[model samples]
Target: MIKVAFFDAKSYDEVSFNKTNADYGFDIRYYQEHLNLKTVPLAKGADVVCIFVNAECNAAVIDELIKNGVKLIALRCAGFNNVDLKAAKGRIKVVRVPAYSPHAVAEYAVSLMLALNRKIFRAVNRTREGNFALKGLMGFDMYGKTAGIVGMGRIAKELIKILHGFGMKVLAYDLYPDMEFAKQYDVQMVSLDELYAESDIISLHCPLTPETTFLINAQSIAKMKPGVMIINTGRGKLINTEELIEGLRTKRVGSAGLDVYEEEKNYFYEDRSDKIIDDDVLARLLMMPNVVLTSHQAFFTVEAMHNIALTTLESIKEFGEGKPLTNEVVEQ
Candidate 1:
């Protein structure tokens, strides 16, 4: 029987993973702790090791996994920045779920945008306390506003649809432009500069790579229109937290909504309410009423979770059967 070890297995993860693996004929071992060099030994005889975004699969961790006879590393999420491809070069195969319910994440981004613009979180809190005055609750209509989307991928396309439904003009930028989709959605394919200067709201949907790291830095922020709202549902490093804090302090950025943070690995997926926050930038962000931060749960819908578990288990099964992986991430 194939042995598969899963790291960072939360309650929700176990529920979906088990449901999908029930008939896969694999013996699964789960650990609540993240996978690292110290925990690599636990995968001793396992053929495959599954990990999530928080697990440390660095060079040292990868080396130890290879030493422990781990053949495959299955990532439940799309982003694989946490994994060191150089270390796993020819030793272990890496695979990820490329697309898992884009609508789930897109809708969440729109929800954040709407909540921030409408001051729903603050209004709900005030209403709960029997204070019904709309003293500071002022919001602009989304209709007729220009929305700039940084990526034209699946998630971005879904966001475009929702924004179009709100009667907002859509401006999109992507390395590879989809002319057909742009025409269909009445989205204008514009340059990054135009998108920044013209958009009333800018949302990031790109991945984190060498070219995309800190894509929304001080330089980019300066190009944006004053009082422009920003939303990021993509990777945390895509926006520089320091620059964002500076913008918020100066009021260069009107309001921001984020589901991810640049240095979220230390704070996300864990409870820190009992302890003082060590990250000063994050602490400052939380103090801003205009900023809304979530625990990187934009893709937390049931459909997305089910797809992730099914795809993850299928990747392991494919590797076990000596077949080429459908979602393989190989170095060129």
Candidate 2:
């Protein structure tokens, strides 16, 4: 039987993985700590290692894993930005669940937009204290608003459908244009600059790469309409937090709904409420009335969790059977 070690193992991860591992019967080991260079020794004797989004699978960690006889690196999450593919090129194969329940994230993105626009967070807090005044709770209708989507992937498509249902215009920008989907959904495939200038709200669903790193900066934010709402359900590093804070200070960005942050590695997915927040930008953002932030939980739905576990194990099983790894990530 192939042995596998899972890092960054949470209670939910254990529940889902243990339920699914019964089918494959792999010798699965769970570690609550994140996988890093120092923790590579924990993976000794295991043929494969499974990791989450926050694990630091750098060159040194990959080298040690190879030295420990590890063959494959299976990522439970979709994003592999933290992994160094070049270091594992010839030594260890890497696979990930690329698309698992896109609706889970897509729906959550819409929820963020709605919650921010209608000031739902503020309303709930006031009501809890018996303050039922609607003075600061005024909101605009979404029917005539235009939403600019940064990517046309599966999650963006799902978001487009939801936005269309609310009678919102959809403008999308993608490296590879899908005219068929645009025509079907009544979405306009526009240039990035045009989308930035014309959109009343902008949402990022793109992956993190050299071209997309810090895609939302001062320059891009300058081109956007005044008081435009920005939403990011994609990778954290896509936005420059300092620039965002500046925009918030100047009221250039009316509001923001973020499920991820650029410096989220230290605080996200962990219970640090009892401790002082060291990240000043994140602390300031939390104090803002217009900004709504969630702990990278857009993909935490039951359906998505189950699919992530099933697809992850199925890929490992395929690798063991000498079949093609459909989700194997190759160097670009």
Candidate 3:
């Protein structure tokens, strides 16, 4: 029986992985704490360590895991931005569930847009308080609107399809553009400048790399259409929170839908309602009515969770069998 250490373990994570492990039967120990220098000792005596988005898989943690004889790091999420791939390159194998359900995130992005557009949460509260007044709930039709999508990944492709059904014209920017997919989906492959200048809604679906950090800064916001809606289901570092707050304060950007925050690892997965949040940037975002903030839950659908558990367990089984890692993330 292979020993597995699971970090950042939530109830949902335990439920899914335990159910899936009935087949593979790997001994998985769940830890509520994150994978960091302090918690790395918990992984000792384990064959592999399973982590999620919030786990800190820095070089230090990687070194400790290697010292502990842990050979594999399995991430049950698509984004590996938190993982130090360079350090793990030669020492340990790193794998992730790249595409559990693109539809889950894409649809959640749409939900955020709808929530911001219609002021659904505010309305629900108003009705419950017997204050059903229809004064500030005006929303423009998505028909004939242009949506600019950054990073034409799987989630972006799914988002484009949904936007098209709403009679939206899609403009996309990608470092490696798929011309065939664009042509097939009636999307225009445009430059970042053009996408920013003309779009009513700007959606980010890019990864967090050195090149993409703070991609939505004040300079880029200045180029966008006034009152432009910004939706980010991508990594939190993709947008600068301070600049975004300024944009919202001045009404330069109309609304925002954020599922990820740069400093989310400290507070996202856990219940922090009882504690006073010390993150001022996040608190500012919470106060804004135009911003619909979610705790990185864009990929929390039951379907996606099941797939993630099954795929992660499968990868672990394959490694134990000494087979080729189909979903291994090789450092570029």
Candidate 4:
């Protein structure tokens, strides 16, 4: 049996994998501790080390894994930005579930947009307290508004379809433009500046690359239409949190929906309600009524979780059998 040291093991993860692993029958050990330098020793004799977005798979950690006889690094989440692929090269194999469900994330982005625009969170709180005054519950119609999408990936494509259904003119920007898909969907492929100036709402779905980090900084926000709504369900560092707060302060950004933060790895998955947030930027963001911060749960749907478990386990099984790993993450 292939031993898998599953790190950052949440109860939901265990539930999903345990049910799916019945068919694969791999020896699985679950640990709530994240995969880091200190926790890497737990995988001393394991054949595979399972990790999530929060796992610290830096070069040093990779070296430790190699010393411990670990051969494979299995990432359960879609984003591998946290992992050092350059360091993992030519050493241990790395594989990820390229996509579990695009709809789940896209739908959550839409929900954020709706909640912010309609002041749904505020209204719910007021009504629950029996203060049902409509003084600040005004919302504009989504119809006839222009929505700009940062990346035309799977989640962006799904979001575009939904936005178009609501009579929103979609403007998309991608490093690589899929002209065929754009033409089919009647989406206008525009330059970043054009999208920023023309869009009433801008949503990010891009990957976190060196070039894309802090993509939404002060300079970019300055080019956007005044009071433009920004929604980010993508990687946290995609937007500079300090700059976003400044934009909100000056009314440059009307509202923002954030499911991830740049420093989210510290406090996103873990419960810190009892303890005050030590990060000043994150705490300031929390104080903003315009901002709706979620705990990186855009991909929490049951269907998505099931697919993630099945796909991750299947990749491990293939690695064990020496089969071609279609989902393997090789150095590009």
Candidate 5:
């Protein structure tokens, strides 16, 4: 039987993973704490180790895993930024659920955009206190508006379909152009500069890489249309939080709907409301009336979770059976 050690297995995580692996014929061990160099011994005879986002898979952790006879690293989420790819280049194989449910993330991005644009969060809070005045609840219609989408991936393409249904024009920018999909969806591929300058609402769905880190900075914001609404359901650090705050303060950015933040690992996936928020940037972001932030829940839907678990377990099974992993990540 193949032995699998799942690190960072919270209550929900175990429930979902077990539900999917009921008949997979694998001996699975769950650990509540995150996997690291010190905890690498937990994987002592296991063939595979499963991890999630926020877990530190640095060089030290990778070295320890290799010493413990671990062969594969299966990531339940799409982003593998936490892993040290350099260390795992030739030693162990790394696999991830690259595309789970694009609709879940795309819908959440749209929900954030709608909530921020219509001031829904503020309005709900006021009404709960029995203040039903419409003094500051003004919002624009989505019809005929132009939306800019960064990185035309699966989620971005799904968002384009929804935006098109709402009578909004879609402008997209991607490193590799999919001209066939663009023509089918009636989306116009444009330069990044044009996308920033002409879009009323800008959404980010790109991955996190060295080139994409802090892609939206002070200079980029300066090039954007005044009062442009920004939405990010992609990886955090894509937008420079300090510069974003400056944009919000100056009203250069009319509003923002963010599902991720640069310093989210400290606060997200846990409740910090009982204590004072230690991060000033996160605190300031919360104080903005036009800003709406969620705890990286763009891919938290039931369907996405199930798909992620199934795909991850299937990859583990394939590795154990000496079959080639269909979702393997290789270094160039």
Candidate 6:
């Protein structure tokens, strides 16, 4: 019997994984705490250890897993930046659920854009307080506006379709351009500079790599058109939070929506409503009415969760059977 230990197991995770495990019959152990060096011993008797996005799988944690006789690290989410692939190389195989539900995240990104543009968040707050005046609820029409998408991945493609429904011109940038898709969607593939200068709304759908980290800093923000709305459903580190605060301070950025943050590991999945947020930049973003922040919930739908659990267990079963690991992440 193959044993798998899951870290950062929330109620939803347990329910989904247990339901899916009925088919696999794997001995799965659940731990509420995230996997770090401190909690490494919990995987002592497991052959495979599964982790979520925020779990710490640094060199130290990887070393402990090897010592514990663990053979594989299965990531439940698509993004694997949290796992140190370099350290796990040649020691333990790392696999992930690459595309559980691109539509879930893409739809959430659109929801953020709609909420910000229509002032839905503020309007809901005002109605609860018995203030139904439309004095400051003015919003511009989305039709005929230009929307710039930073990446041309699966999620971005889903968003492009929705943006087309709104009659918005789509401008996209990707290192490896998919000209066929661009032609199909009638999207203009432009340089990053052109996308920044011409777009009415800029949305990020890229991954967080060494080259793409802090991609939307002060220098990039300066190139953007004044009053350009910015939206990020990508990795948190894609935008420098401090620089974003400065952009919001001035009127340079008309409105902003984010589902991720650079330093979100400390506060995103956990509840800290009773405690004060020590992160100054995050606190400042919360104070801005134009800014809307979600706690990394772009991939939180029931379908996505079910797909994640099914795919994750399937990969583990593949590894157990000595089959080809399709979603394996090698050292880059």
lDDT of 5 at 170: 93
Better of 1 and 5 by lDDT: 1
- lDDT against the true structure, per candidate, is 0.92, 0.94, 0.94, 0.94, 0.92, 0.93
Q: List the residue pairs that clash in candidate 2.
A: none
TM of each candidate vs. truth: 0.98, 0.99, 0.99, 0.99, 0.97, 0.99
lDDT of 1 by residue, 178-265 (tens): 9999999999999999999999999999888999999999999999999889999999999999998888878889999999998888
- Per-residue lDDT tens digits for candidate 4, residues 1-332, read 99999999999999999999999999999998999999999999999999999899999999999999999999998889888999999888999988899999999999999999999999999999999899989989999999999999999999998998999999999989899989888899999999999999999999998999999999999999999999999999999999999999999999999999998888978888899788999989989999999999999999999999999999999999999887998877
Clashing pairs in 6: none
lDDT string for model 2 (258-312, tens) is 9999989888999998999988999999999999999999999989999999999
1-332, model 3: which lDDT tens digit per residue? Answer: 89999998989889998998999989999999899999999999999999988898999999999999999999999989889999999899999999999999999999988898888999998999999899998888889999999999999999999999999999999999999999988999999999999999999998889999999999999999999999999899999999999999999999999999989989898888999989999999999999999999999999999999999999999999999999999899
Each candidate: RMSD: 1.0, 0.7, 0.8, 0.8, 1.1, 0.8
What overall lDDT, based on C-alpha atoms, would model 5 receive against the true structure? 0.92
What are the per-model numbers of colliding residue pairs? 0, 0, 0, 0, 0, 0
Residue 102 accuracy (lDDT) in model 3: 96
- Model 2 regions more than 4 Å off: none
Considering lDDT, which of the candidate structures 1 and 3 is the better prediction for this target? 3
lDDT of 6 by residue, 91-158 (tens): 89999998999999989999998999999999999999999999888888999999999999999999
User: Who is ahead in lDDT, 3 or 5?
Assistant: 3
Which candidate do you rate higher for TM-score, 3 or 5?
A: 3
